[model samples]
Target chain A: MSNKARVPAVDGWFTMDDEPKLLASRGVETGSYFFPKNLAFSRNPAAPTEALEECTLSRRGRVWSWTTNHYKPPAPYISTDEFVPYTVVAVELVDEQMVVLGPLATSCDPSELSIGAEVELVLGRLYEDEDNEYVVWQWKVVQ
Target chain B: MAVEGRSVSDVVVLGVGMHPWGKWGRNFVEYGVAAAHAALADANVDWRDVQLVCGADTMRNGYPGYVAGATFAQALGWQGAEVSSSYAACASGATALNAARAQILAGLCDVALVVGADTTPKGFLAPNAGDRPDDPDWLRFRLLGASNPTYWGMYARRRMEMFGATPADFARVKVKNARHGVSNPNARYRKLVTEAEVAASPMVSDPLRLLEICATSDGGAALIISSLEYAKAHGVTNPVRIAALSTVTPSYPNTLIDMPNFSTDSSFGVAAPERGFRDSIAHAAYEKSGIGPQDLDLAEVYDLSTALELDWYENIGLCKEGEAEQLLNSGETTIGGRIPVNPSGGLGSFGEAVPAQAIAQVCEIAWHLRGEAGDRQVEGAKVGLTVNQGLFGHGSCVILKK
Candidate 1:
């Protein structure tokens, strides 16, 4: 690997460790979970005033649904000179009982994946500059 | 518990009009003014006599689009009318219509006008140009490259896996809608499409081909409504009336994946809603108007993708879950079928004009109810419904009757 610093494309959204976990928020009173950490307020209307706490989501989950994106999405998505098609999957977290979306890992074969397949979160390169590599959480099919 | 019949809150639709859907590249104000004039003439109401103007907001346009009510009023020569502007993504038109309906029902205004128009960019609707990480609409694209079609593909894939819906089943929806749109004067594409043609189109998102998805278009639609008493006083009798207008938000713990969001509401703490968000939109209208699915003669549903139209078949209570494909194959949803849908050709033929779409749905339904839809008319149609949902939790269902 080249000598370059690895940084999150969007900070504080997920962990950078080998076993990356999505950072989320859970309502203290209602036990509801929110990905990307809903810091403003509890989204669960049943407990409108419940306090939220920082928590990590389940790393492994089943593929709830998936699609292969053939076209290069428009920006804020940082793109390279050449665009490569990628697979996107919505995974249902094992414990949170909610679905979260992300791209599939670069090494995985999208053709082999299907709904109800198990997958785990891992950090993958989104884009890169001369000095630093930008990374985001991606889903890797579990062998 | 369904309410029996027309309640005192019903508002009469005096007139409806629309600018033809296309990529005309004109200022949205031009389309809005044109549609407004047509509607005013149809209603036989002077512009100066309108008491309130409700405008559906379009974000793609400039500042004037945000204050659309005042903009349209000023474009129509500043009639000093009370104005309101509403924005709810794709549901903007329905939200604006609801605002006008509420004013008429509350006795605040005897006559009100609702208008929505948009001038869209050519390709996939991009988020407002910026590098903001906080916005979910941007984050979904930035983090996962999840364009709107990505969600449509996923939903189509789910139907394929769970309900055994095939690509051919999806293609049939396009063919059926194209056939209906052939006679529509205002539809951007007034032609027939075959299943083979749809199959030959390039795939944009996995199972969804480019032909199966709708494009963005420039168009406008407007409605003139009044209190029932106002219609009677104006020598108009038996006008088409809006029996129920449901603009309801999703209940908590929504599990279905929706647009512009990375995650669904967690059902860990609370039970999932009895009816999913999409199902509840029409359910509320049926409950309020006492017009069950069996009573609907025709429907104008949002068909952003062909497969989604099949999903709406179940969502609107036309068929049970996993039965939309069978419903389409049986030819039950076609023009002469049990319940004709998207008789205006839906977004499949017209493409989408964003803020103007929901109002256009109502406009199509009004035409059939008034026996003015010409060749595409559903004979002896007395009642119709329109359903559409926007990004976030904005969704509406409107039931109209003669």
Candidate 2:
């Protein structure tokens, strides 16, 4: 399996302390979320960290809309060229009066996703670069 | 404001054209040419007569571009018309429209043509090649794996949680737009989508389902615009006068985490942030036209996702935040209702064509104002408005009159 891909070579960002990691920037708005400094990742690399606050409060929203990652994320996202389907869901949070983004577990399928299904947030990785798995927040139907 | 209804430049739209949006196998230039030609023909003017041309650009395709001025000029047979290209994500078309209006208003051109087209690649649109640690799109992809839909989902979830908007409410919007899409000859998924169908759509991001979301497509849209005097000299008396074209960038200290690829700005940066991004766009238009949202008979907003449409309602002052749902559900936002919105299927129905989408929204208002829209016409759509917000804080809005 061709695991490591030469994505790009660039400067990495860091916080008050820690070494910079490889990063890809666009215009400004860097190191905000996707490309946090290595300091942030080194703090808790294994799990998804909340940016502002993670309200354990459950939100009651019917599924607003959804799309399936029928094909695995393209090149830079995953290690293999193989295609895998991942359901991407958008659930309306009940009380927060806002929305959150996340990925569906790989076990989900397009046929399985329907509108108006009560859903909740799920944090996981889409794929992994050899050094670290590309992690982000996603959603799943809250059975 | 206008106590006696003072006049502005009053540019008129002569013609509008668009390439049918779908998964067409073609390059962006092809769609652009088709729409440009259609606009020229619709205007009853020859391509050679066009004095200026502007194109909206796509970043995925715009990296290291040769300004696309000559490329698009060549695509439309290279009549040597002045050309310009704009890139502002989904708002590129509107930005290009702004450039064309500016040139015409500045007396730099007689009749200007604006065109925007895009042939989107399948799957989540990602950042460009190479690692620019400072680039926000790249950082988001690297850190969050939060694809474009993630941000859309975030707003959707937030809206529901913050407000009492139900998923069923969001589905109603999809159903309404899908019905409109089915009638639109240029829309990608034109079948009438049902609320139940929207409910049944599999979850792609979270609460958002497949049917509820708008898809990326290959298409083009174009417009032919002329200063009022030019239109009158060209044996035209009545035309859709674009009273104002406003394109404003977002101010600093924006709280909303707009880019799923990146987090909200640290706010610790600069003081006296200019203004909220979306408000600035509308304010610029109002400044130019000397009119407020109260004068708008109808509007077309960027509905990249259903929830964003609600945000626009607040931004444009259609109603207060969290009140858009009440407004929509009350049928106050319908075609015959007060302050009708998205009467032309919107991005939800027509699909996004990058540079062309914004221009196309204006075309819809023009058509409605001209009393040409067959079914989705807003009644007495005089003094129409079109508003759009693009990535990187780029935004646009135009006020029009007959």
Candidate 3:
């Protein structure tokens, strides 16, 4: 990897730590979790907007479903010189009781995963420019 | 079956029409106007007699597509008729229909027209051109490169893992729909498809081949509806009537992963709803019309993917969960089965025209109810239903009876 600066493709969605967790908002009264940190208000109608609070989501989950994208998607997706098919997975967190979707780590093969395979969140480089690397959250198999 | 103590009067479908689905590279307004004219002629009502027009908006075109109600009205030579526009992604057609039906029920207008049409681009349907990171549709593409097919593939794979649904089972859905399409003059792909053909087609998303997934196309569909009194006054007797319409959203703690979203609603705090979002769409209609699956002579479900059709079979209560493949294998969902589905070829043959699709489903159902569908008609078909869902939380279902 080049010694360029590391930055998030979309800022404030996650942290750049070695073991990353998704930043999210939770309904203080209802306990509902929202990814990407919804500070606007509580999605639950039973709760008030003042009940919303920011928090980090669970870092580990089980694969609820998965698939391989065989074709390159159109933009705002940034692709490298040659497009490579990647595996997308939906992982269900036990505590949150919700399924979150993301791409598998670049080093992991899709064949290595099953419906209930364990996975953990990680930070990975999505695309890189000359001076900086754009990163996003990815799911890695928990061996 | 009818809703007891029902205060709302039924809306009669005076006539229905469609512009043939294809890759026609033209202005969407042309298709909408053609469909509207055909509907007016079929209803035998003068265009000037139409009191209201409800339009399903298309995003592909510019401001005109966004305000499609006025767009179609202007193209059809506006006579100062009241107009309304609605957009709920794939459910736009049904939503617009519901809008017109509600107006008629509220005594706002006696005679109304519902129209939806679209002229799609070449490839995958992308989000609006912008750099907005706040949009989930845009963020999904920018962050994970996950296209719509990715979700379809995952759903198919989940069915395989949970219910042992094989790829062959999914292919058979396409084959059956393709056979149905051969008789539908308005379908985009009329050629019969075989399981081998489905298998041979390229795979856009694994576990789902290109042929098994719907393609985007240009199309338009329209319906002229009115109060029962209005239909009777026009000398139209025994017209098909809209019995129920459900345009509901997902309940709190919706756990099912849906399209254009990164995560499902967390159910840790709030308890999950009694019914999943998809199940609730048709359930609400069934409750409203008091017509269950057993009463349905035929169904027109959004078969965005062949597997999704099988999922709809269960969601609409044609079969129990994990038993849709069994229903398919038993020849129950085929054209000659106990409850035929997608006799109009579904999205498998027509592809998708976004705004026009849900209305197209209604048109197919109304045709069957009125004994107007030539070869694809279900024998003695009386009651029919159409179900579709848009991106985010839009849920749509409509039930009709002769």
How does residue B25 of candidate 3 score in lDDT?
A: 97
Model 2 residue B113 CA deviation (Å) reads 1.1
lDDT of 3 at B345: 94
B303, model 3: CA deviation in Å?
0.5
lDDT of 2: 0.68
Which candidate do you rate higher for lDDT, 2 or 3?
3
True contacts kept of each: 0.87, 0.11, 0.91
Please give, for residues B5-34, the per-residue lDDT of candidate 1 as tens digits: 334455999999899999999999999998
Per candidate, the number of residue pairs that clash is 0, 56, 0
**Candidate 2's residue-wise lDDT over B55-165, tens digit each?**
777555554232554567887787768788777777787778878877776767778888877778875666787855576677555544556766777678668777978
How accurately is candidate 2 docked according to DockQ? 0.11
Model-by-model DockQ, in order: 0.87, 0.11, 0.88
> What residue runs in model 3 are displaced by over 4 Å at the alpha carbon?
B1-8
Instruction: Please provide TM-scores computed only on chain A for all of the candidate models, following their numbering.
Output: 0.96, 0.47, 0.96
Candidate 2 chain B: worst-modelled 10 consecutive residues by lDDT: B1-10
